[model samples]
Target: MEESFMPKVSVIIPVFNVESYLAECLDSVIGQSFYDMEIICIDDCSTDNSLNILMAYAHRDSRVIILRNDCNRGLAFTRNVGLERASGDYILFVDSDDYIVKDLVGITINEIDSVDMVCFNYKKKDEIWNSGDEHIFKMKRGIYEAQEFFVDTVNNNSVVHSAWSKLYKREFLMQEDIRFITGILYEDIVFHFLCMMKAHKISCIPEQLYLYRVRNDSIMTKRVESKNITDYFRIACFIGQFYLEHSFDTRLEKAIEQYIQTVYHSFICNYRRYELANHGYILKEAIAEKRFAKIFGIVSGIENYYGRVQKKIEENIGLIKDGNSILVYGAGDIAKEVIETLNYYDVILEGVAVSDKSGNRKSLFGNKVREITEYLYKRDESLVILAVTYKFYPEIKLKLSELGFNHYLEIF
Candidate 1:
């Protein structure tokens, strides 16, 4: 290729022990309709065949560039190495296991010329499940001012705080000196937040082009350790300090506050009592400073709201008749919690019903997993408990009712 024909997008993939899915990921990138792209795979001292796979691809494709770490530095440092080595006009970070749509680069490149970053949507899947075309929310496609984008995304919860689904201008990242927090598990939390703050213009597209594979080995799926709990607070403190250092408008300040509050709420929900006790002082100090009053107020309101919801659910337990079969809809983390709560109460269940798009699973929570359509066909007079997030509750309720299911409850 000539110098003018250089790759427009430099895809930085940080590879670890992902031999099982590496080929699929590489194939997706190499087969993209937009072929003017360089694939930079950073091998973080993998013990598996991940490095060899990258080497093989490099031998066959001139666009493949293989880099290695001397030792096993974590994802943050490895990504930093990729950022330093990237040569394209725009940079995209792709996890080794995930794949993207064939025209993702072409679509993003066409829309990203006047924006600092382009944020797109993604689908979350399991080993067998693939969330095809179903997105959480539909966002308008246009260029947005930085504050407007932050309000629509981080504040409204339309976008996830992840780097993978976004395309960044190489010059913007370099000029802002944006880098990940080394030796931290949830480094993306801070990095993504800072990018939104620094970007002058951001473009939002509704296309679900990225496929995020949910696996047990991933850090987010793993049991929450004390380190993970502390990392949340660490990032909160970092963001709080950054806010103090910079002068932002009231709207942006409120958005940042909401973002930090969400992170703190997640920490409280996931951590044990002992872990909370250990880090409770940080919360107390933040409150004392009065800088996070909005966060505290939001957290307090959420607690009260959830408490009322829990009370309602408890009082309505009598609605479930004795010996009535129960079918839980959704097979996500919240669904698992619902199943466990039912098990604790010794409630018998018929089975778990999942959407057709999620593929099929043998079982969930020791109950057989059946498709929603199949379960609907069985005239079991079952009470279907929709165990999904609050945002999807209304749509799910409407769908179940349309399918002729009379008895259903949504556990937000």
Candidate 2:
């Protein structure tokens, strides 16, 4: 631990009131199989014994560098402080309440030799550590050209944005000036997107190297609030501007459109969840933001397409009337709107169907929800309205075709 010798990796952990988990997190980092690294612990003026725990670690381990804020800065500011002080070759962000596997640093560093970033898997520390639901997108383990990788991953809906699951090259980050957006909840979204855009080479592996603690009180798990709604809109606006500032190749058009469309859909979903009398005003305010204009333009196009689909459904009302049973094949906000629209025409739906029940609503509009396969028997005589986003349309259509359910129409 000489002053002249630089470490290969700088492990940054931003701390708040996580004293109970701080020691365990530090132990995991200090006991890494890769020993040539510095652990930068930035404490954000915790009211608890978190600062004391960090001091104790710094006392025993010279590699543990502690920096304290004068006041309670948020996670983004604390992480920025660590990044400013980090002198290692690479950077790895670890939350204070989370712990990692012994070889996380070693394996990640080994994989990041020629790559600007190395993204691996992680396990959720629930009742038992499990990786079943950790990765929502399926990606192969290999090295890829970063721009093509970003375009394909975003296009195919096979990308992850969690900052903690990746190892980044310090020079690459510094060259691009990539840092978390201050005063935002989902800063990782913007941070990772910019890194993906600027990076030259990237690697992906299947090893579950990190353990993410899933607690009820965590910011991600907390109930949605007004800040969450407004902050997310602000993030969306930032991303929209980023897309416009960079006129990427025409081939990347679909990828960028997909990203914006997904963000807009989530914005609407969360806006709906936030029950308030001023919801329309919030919506208008978001639309009024000058930077958000591009994003809203994309949304407008999508809504216009759906508007045509709604008219077609209205014109083909006889199709639903001819069916022995009627069902909606999605459980998202669009599906709810579709159902409500159909109900306005006095059409009765038998049930709501989903490709999978996990992380989906069990019911919609007083209709029972079940797997799409469960409704296959009635498909011959039933009229199924496919109400999912178009990105998933081809796969769902293929599944329906494989299941021999031909009496269906997609409301893309």
Residue pairs of candidate 2 with colliding backbone atoms: none
Clash tally, candidates in order = 0, 0
How do the residues 276-355 of candidate 2 rate in per-residue lDDT, one tens digit apiece?
45656667777677555555564442244435446667777887877778888888767866876686578878788898
Off by over 4 Å in 2: 126-132, 289-294, 297-412
Q: 247-295 in candidate 1: lDDT tens per residue?
A: 8788888888877766665554444322456666655554464565555
Looking at model 2, residue 353 earns an lDDT score of 89
Q: How many clashing residue pairs are found in candidate 1?
A: 0
Worst 10 residues of 1 by lDDT: 300-309
C-alpha TM-scores of all predictions = 0.75, 0.74
